[model samples]
Target: MLLLALLEAAGIAKLGASIGAGIAAIGAGLGIGRIGSSAMEAIARQPESTGDIRTNMIIAAGFVEGVALFAVIVCLLCLFL
Candidate 1:
């Protein structure tokens, strides 16, 4: 009985980790999409500041991706430990 319970708990942990990783990926995608859209709009409105806008957009997107990566790693850790 105890062994069965342990297996069930491990399964549940793996499932939760997978779900969490998926959610993190989705969130990062949405965030980067929004940043890109906004940056394009800003560049269109002020063509002369294109360089600045692009740089800022890339920085923001990088930050979002980093955070998402961290979240995924944490979730994966949950599955293993």
Candidate 2:
């Protein structure tokens, strides 16, 4: 991949990969945190809609986690291959 090539040329492929993975994890954490915060606020505002808010929050968190996992896997591959 072009990205790999560039990193290799710069002699920091492993470092880059590690940093990328860390960033992905941090971003996911932030995204999930925001989702939870918003969901709680929404639930507080509308107690009767707790079920809907919780469901949407979980779904959004799952999506963010999935993306983070994919990013981490890609970074690991880049580090090893």
Which candidate should be chosen as best, given TM-score against the real structure?
A: 2
lDDT tens digits, residues 1-81, model 1?
A: 776468657697688789999999999999999999999999999999999999999999999999999999999887776
lDDT of each: 0.92, 0.94
Prediction 1 TM-score vs. true: 0.87
Cα lDDT over the full model 1: 0.92
**What are the clash counts of all predictions, listed in order?**
0, 0
Worst lDDT 10-window in candidate 1 = 1-10
Which sections of candidate 2 miss by over 4 Å? 1-10
Best by lDDT: 2
RMSD of each: 3.6, 2.1
TM-scores for all predictions:
0.87, 0.89
